[model samples]
Target: MSVDKTFYVTTPIYYVNDKPHIGHAYTTLACDVLARFKRLDGYDVKFLTGTDEHGQKVEKSAEGFGTSPQELADRNSANFRELAARLDCSNDDFIRTTEPRHIRSVQALWARLVAAGDIYVGHYEGWYSVRDEAFYGEDELVPGPNGTKHAPSGAPVEWVKEPSYFFRLSAWQDRLLAWYEANPDCIGPQSRRNEVISFVKGGLQDLSVSRTSFKWGIPVPGDDAHVMYVWLDALTNYITAIGYPDITGEFARYWPADLHMVGKDIVRFHAVYWPAFLMAAGLEPPRRVFAHGWWTNEGQKISKSVGNVIDPVALIERYGLDQVRYFLLREVPFGNDGDFSHRAMVQRMNSELANDYGNLAQRVLSMIGKNCAGQVPQHGEPGADDREMLDAAHGLLPKVRDAIDRQLFHEALEAMWGVIRAANGYVDRQAPWALKKTDPARMGTVLWVLAETVRNLALLTQAFMPAASGRLLDQLGIGPDARTLHHCGSHHALKPGTPLPAPAGVFPRFVEEEGAA
Candidate 1:
């Protein structure tokens, strides 16, 4: 809660076997919004995202593409970088496993785990899902097509037997359980925590950490015959970005990251394996791991075969970027699955944004422009309705902050919209145009109250909707330094008689083609 503390948050490094999709954009956008909120909240924030380019799956994909693994990684990783830019992501660093710095850190972490006696040579014979890049016990497999076994996740598995180095995951099960007990908040969204707890309760087996079957990974230290498991190399990217192992600068400032935002499919890696690995290496685990669910398109699972895989770039092209950004977090509660539909998107755009928030800015700022000689108006004597709306606006910061802190993005947006709704109602009741003739002072007060409220709303919502909010702030005569929470909350006055630009609607109604939904 203190501004002096650092907030380090990360999205899971996306696997670079293919191009970016709605799922990847969704997670990175969430992290971006949180990072922006923290910076506006006065925290020193370090946000990270990147591609996980090392793995057997990537190698196979490269072969299919008629390219070497590094060539494939180079091409696909650039796509992710381009996607981040297109999405307006504010990630502080973008790391790839192929980077020398990352390779060094991964190897350092491996040596640390090895030195701690938590890793040993072993033979692994199990059901391996190349798609999932995970090994499963026979009992955990379900029937698949062609009489083959699949992971519970339905990813087809192949029986794999190989020489591998194993991490003593079973040895740390009790320690992990005890750690979870001591720090119950470490894994979030009670349902996710319960799922993790239940999984650990079923017991853990020693995990194979090095793969000899594939050479498209970080080579194990002192062993050229094997490569470190992809997850180990990938997860260590967090520390690598922060200058870990050496432990200076960013590492010293933001080690033991405040949050690891991952998808539900990979929760076990962060909640179980990651923490155990950290503790075994004599390091502290991350402060929290919050796993969010997947997204669906039009009530069906999103897949390439379905011809409905939502391309983030195409979605942004179809809808405005901030509009897409706003709907993603606002339509769904942060830790739950959500569906994307054109109908839903249009509704959110036209109603919540265009009508509720954008309309308020347009109507009140327009009134100020016409009535107050095109400048911010001064307040009149305090009145009940004015104070009520002012109270609602003033109360917004803490409420939004509380929701954002809990990662309840829907709650935050809803709370901001509550104040916005009240401001709109105040406009209807006072009818500022009528006041121009008789109660001019009261009208000025109303317009002033509305402008200040709109200013706060713009600044507050900027994290969620940057481009649109920037336009809103520009119309209100606000600039960069004036947009922080401290500035918004200080009861500051916009410069009276400061000439303002004509306001324009930021969110326009989305019109869908026939049968689009």
Candidate 2:
């Protein structure tokens, strides 16, 4: 693919102070789905994810663990990297903020901002949340117990006063609002965009860009005592991963990333500060920043103290991998809060996957195996029902493409399942088994039509459930080269008389043990 066909997407580099959780998996899975969809559509896609290692949180956590910060970062970063593989995320690059290349890239960005007169030495006094690595103004804090104050996120704050470098965020207020107005789609979900606009319009302040009290972050260029603030250093990872400061290689090809997928809590950093930082440095901001909502487990907010943080690995171990992936993206609308329950997961698994889609593939293939001599049944055409079903299956590409472009994963899956439900009804209405006796040739055409529909369904579904879709396509005798989005219409229908593999269930029904929770 050429540069014009490139699509770059990213997940926030996760913090190393916390273990991998469902939130991390959720954000990355959404990006993976988008990247996969773009690739199938013939775009040269770059999917980037990694760990954010520099921050006072990680430094303090390192002290508590009785290890050096680097050692702590190393061990925890490896766990996150392993999680990506376990979740089957198809990321193109895994970057660590601690890498030497990143350090150089960050320093170069600092130089650019300094040359632009955006950074200057100043005294900073404010409430800082080490946990969130953010500065909170007086109005944003909530009253806590014992006359203390806490950040809106509920993380405790501490008063800090020191000499630091400041970014002229206040100076960019009008420009930022103008950019938001000019490029309305730059920030996603409409709700998030409104929140960011309100925050900026209320007032912008010169943001502190360096910390003198903590030595765990990237040091400001030419200043040894002060280190760059965590958000400044962390947000640069997006550009650094693609070789920033050179803008001649991958950076030139994929800069101005197509999308940056993040959780809702950090919208201020991506939508506000990160873009300002880039524009100051003579670089283009990413095309879009999508902030998805949080997930609660069984009605309670997921917290370590609650002892209910959903581990992605454990979820996959209990239910199948694709089962977990499908339920996550299918269970709730993107950009909205969702609850995770065992009941809901199992229901989707059994009814949607097993009964609706899985059973459709099984019955049709089983008939071919037994009645059609175990090969793709030859079809004699011109039936209205067949045309309607085929057209629906073939038409799914555009509907899904539109939904996914807007980051509507659940809607895309629902559109695909709509056809699945119709295919099930088609089978019932056609009654291929009844035709087996009266008109054997008519039964063959119905079965062939169903098979062609399944082939298209599998092709479109490969983005959401890669492993399961690949297995389904394999059962249909689809070659690896013939599985892209272009291969989904009638032009690429399954060939007659091609030998299919023995039929087996792709999505198994989830059964709960009697004594389990």
Candidate 3:
């Protein structure tokens, strides 16, 4: 199908209280891959990711670090930016809530809601969980082991009485339910959508939108003593980065994002609260909210308190960046929780990258270099096996497009690898090395088909393993403009007689230091 619509996607603005770990990296990487795929598919894409710099947790972290809130935000937010670079994320904008643009946007949204009578002053007397930065209703609290009541998320809550500005979340229930019913696919993966539906059906209390006790957040418009709730402040980063409240620019082009990729833990904020807030401000809600599951370490849940958070930087250092990216996306289904294990990572990298993909590319390119004078060779009359192999490679583009459209990343990779695996089998059965001595013309034809397949595979691999894909494309002598989805389905993709660069491996096998090669 032809796609002409603009594609805008956002990762949840990570909290600035801590540095990035595997969880943060996973969400960012998913967004990056989708953005890359959309761009390659001829869509105008804007990718946004950054830090949620204002919250009570950040304030407490600042105090614990013996620094001011702004100072802590600056330091930690910079770390997030660095992580994006390390992961090779191609985000168009990195928004921080403390920026002047964001503050203006947040305050402007507050004024709009206030003008619409969605905001009202009220007394908030309930159980609050600082860790979750949320209020739990009396019935939602679970009994803790120490005779204390905890939030449903297992975070301890304290009863606090304070004056705050309330958002008319309760008033939007019928409207939200109607909106959701009208748009059945608004929330992704079906399971997440059902969770949101159940929560809204259960009923919503008017949420506290302004917290008087938190002095580190954006101040409510016309009420300087009260700061807007951190979620109200943070979720605005999506539009704030896109130039909201000013209208008719980036905001007009990308305001209603095509997707909001978030973790499952924050489904309510994105699926329920964010849409209601947008509707209240006379804005369109995003097209979809996809909340993906989390990860564990070696079958054990990873937690900061347990000291089991896997550092992504360390993983990248041990395994190549593209290898790590490939393993993460290929190892698990996109919307399901995955486990991270060193053994799994090593086995996947060594077997898939080194054995299947890398070996095929190396074997074909080396043979071409030796027999065809290091140039893309010409094809002869197609034999039956050659036709089937080329057809498989030529047919991959649509399958990849379909898989990526649904965020089925693993399926996309699997489709590409299927072509590679077939090419491997064809190479062995045809015995191109034997054909070189017996019939040179047949050898050229076989090598030509394999080269074209590798070129298309490398092009498709860009969305997931850009660095390694670039190396493969360079070795194939493919040009920059020709390496997009527009040319992925062509049978005559590789230009015959084009000089190819010397063969070098793209994906290196992982080995332990004790068994150094």
Give per-residue lDDT, candidate 1, residue 215.
90
Q: Compare the candidates by TM-score and give the number of the best one.
A: 2
Question: Candidate 2 at residue 386, lDDT?
Answer: 90
Model 3 worst lDDT run, 10 consecutive residues: 1-10
Poorly placed runs, candidate 2 (over 4 Å): none
Candidate 2 clash pair list: none
lDDT of 3 by residue, 63-173 (tens): 888999999999888999999999999999999999999999999998899889998999999999888888889999999997999999888999989999999999999
Residues 260-356, candidate 2: write the lDDT tens digits. Answer: 9999999999999999999999999889999999999999999999899999999999998999989999999999999999999999999999999
Mark the regions of model 1 whose C-alpha exceeds 4 Å error after superposition. 1-3, 513-517
Tens digit of per-residue lDDT, candidate 1, span 1-517: 4746699999999888867999999999999999999998889999999999998999999889889999999998999999999999999999998999999898999999989999999798878889988888877899989887889998889888999999999999899999999998899888999999999999899998889888999999999999998888888999999997898888888989999999999999999999998899888999999988899989999887878888999889988999999999999999999999888988999999889987889898888888888888877766988888888887899999999888899999999999998988899999989988998988888898899889889889989999999998999888777888887653675666677888787888777778863
Q: What's the TM-score of every candidate structure? A: 0.97, 0.99, 0.97
Clashes of each: 0, 0, 0
Best by lDDT: 2
CA lDDT, every prediction?
A: 0.90, 0.94, 0.90
Per-residue lDDT value at 59 in model 1: 91
Q: Superposing every Cα of model 3 onto the true structure, what RMSD results?
A: 1.8
